[model samples]
Target: MTVKTTLSFTDRHHRFLTDKVGQGVFASQSAAVAAALEQMIRDEEERELTLGAMADEIRARLDTPRADYVPGENAFATARARLQAAREA
Candidate 1:
């Protein structure tokens, strides 16, 4: 189903869409706008998925026992030593 609606764009945006259509990147201005909207929808969906995964990771870390957690200083020291070794090699 196709719905007809009026949309306003800044001069810059209009020029970009017009250029894309002229270059045959899209069939028309409407097609270019639709493709852009589709890309935006995909980006938003990907962002939501990444946020959810991060939240799950945070929850898992929080559930870990204190004894299993590494001290921040010790972790940083180990990382720095590893980095130094890698640089020397």
Candidate 2:
């Protein structure tokens, strides 16, 4: 299903689309625009999936028992000691 509508583009954008069409990169301006839109949709979907995964990870981390986790100060001191050792080596 295709909907016909008028679209406005800057001169630069028009030239880009025209050049792509001339180079056989796309069948027409509409095809180029559709491809761009499809890419945007994919990017948005990927972003949503990444955010959901990050949220799930945060939730899992929050559910961990406090006693089972290292204190932040201890963690930082250990990291600093490792860094100093690496620098000296």
Candidate 3:
């Protein structure tokens, strides 16, 4: 059998986890903590996707041309310079 270690949380969050366990959403503190971590990971992933989409919308508003899309350090200047250089090349 595998022995497990315990993790501690802040007072309010601890009370929240304890309440969830008490309410039978989870069998124990470990289960409740696992559920909380999973929820946090899910929320983080969603936030990342939302932020990415917002950035894409801003980029679209900038109306950057396809051939001018240079994904380099200092994006704005680089893309413009790259397109200009490519035109002369």
Q: Which stretch of 10 consecutive residues in model 2 shows the poorest summed lDDT?
A: 70-79
lDDT of 1 by residue, 1-89 (tens): 99999999999999999999999999999999899899999999999999999999999999999999988888799779999999999
Model 3 lDDT per residue over 1-89, tens place: 64698776799988988898899889988887777779999999999999999999998968977778666666688678999999999
Candidate 3: list runs displaced more than 4 Å.
1-3, 64-89
lDDT per residue, candidate 2, 1-89, as tens digits? 88999999999999999999999999999999999999999999999999999999999999999889987788799779999999999
Model 2 backbone overlap count: 0
Among the numbered candidates, top TM-score falls to 1
Question: CA RMSD for every model?
Answer: 1.5, 2.5, 13.2
Better candidate number, 1 or 3, judged by lDDT: 1
Regions more than 4 Å wrong, model 1: 76-78
Could you tally the backbone clashes for each prediction?
Answer: 0, 0, 0
Clashing pairs in 1: none
